[model samples]
Target: MTDKTLRSVTIERTGAGHFTATNARGGEIRFGTSSDPDGGADFTPVELLLAAIGGCTAADVDVATGRHSEPTGFTVTVTGDKISDELGNRMTDLAVTFSVAFPDGELGDRARAILPRAVKTSHDRLCTVSRTVEIGTPVTATVADA
Candidate 1:
């Protein structure tokens, strides 16, 4: 991966009721004011941050499983709850949970030995987004058979 940094983004009104957001490199995102008229048109940056964690975790799972010869596929779901300050204002803390699903077949001992390390390495060392969120949020993961 290159040492690319997402420095800044720009948002502009593009239509009668919509707006477009663009990054420094010309990457654009479109949104509308329908959701929260006061809050603004696109998804909040916090929402995008959650998405980044989920996407990175899923991708790491795929690669880790393949590297381990598991050669399987899985689905991941991430959920978060936010805590606010005394004034009933903005979020002060966030708790993030992840659920990972694997195939139904039982691999017994083999899976038991490798799965934990795969997940640990991904969250503890590899995934950039997970590392980023771990800075301010409490992140946890649960693995299940599907």
Candidate 2:
């Protein structure tokens, strides 16, 4: 039996450094290795990774805080340094920063009060993407046999 918790996406190459990922629900996203978003208009693998990290935690934090009060503004920024070393190319010094604003009132005050704790909870355990990266999960690559 397949694991109930298993989630996956199928990636198909469309061209050099370009690909499409289709999820089980048939949602598709196009991405490429191009560094210029304005020129190529595609997200690089590293950028995708950063987006995943931020998006995951953002979802978690949103669920926790939105129930209390909707924010006037919310943003999450994920940043990292890419370096090639003896360990090969990888990201380091990763950081996630949140800029949020709530209205002036009791509900907003409550949301502001819990914002820090909500972010902490997401980073500590709620965000699977960030948690997996933090835990250094192994990735296995294989080619299909003809």
Candidate 3:
């Protein structure tokens, strides 16, 4: 038997190219189409995807480094390139850059030393979002008549 945790989200159209997505926990987010005819005031799907990946890895790195020293500041920038193929447009290469600051001293030294390993650990296994993307998890869709 396999241990599995089920997660689900529901999305409903709000307006032209605008939608609201709600999770089982009752959390909700609004999003819109990325292209012209501008959808809504919220993040687009691709932007949200980048945020998820960045946020996941950032959390993992923060916790790992916290054992040595709590970072005084931290920020992550994620970027990707859109490419075209027979399948249409999709993000091709993605990059994540983390900027972290620590208190100056031995603690800072230790934190710096641990940074690379922490990032590697997150990308290799810890971050659920990035790992899912890297592994190409299968997604199945079903349609029901209304």
The model with the greatest lDDT is 2
lDDT tens string, model 3, 1-146?
Answer: 23367777999999887899999889999998865545435888998999999999999999988989989999999999878899898897899999999998998889989999999999999999999999999878888995
lDDT-wise, the better of 1 and 3 is 3
Candidate 1 lDDT at 43 equals: 61
Candidates by TM-score, descending order: 2, 3, 1
Q: What TM-score does structure 1 among the candidates reach? A: 0.54
**Tens-place lDDT digits, model 2, residues 6-76:** 89999999998899999999999899988965658888889999999999999999998999899999999
The collision pairs in model 2 are none
Worst 10 residues of 2 by lDDT: 33-42
By lDDT rank, best first, the candidates go: 2, 3, 1
Residue pairs in collision within model 3: none
lDDT of every predicted structure (CA atoms): 0.62, 0.94, 0.90
Q: State TM-scores per candidate.
A: 0.54, 0.95, 0.88
- Score residue 24 of candidate 1 by CA lDDT: 72
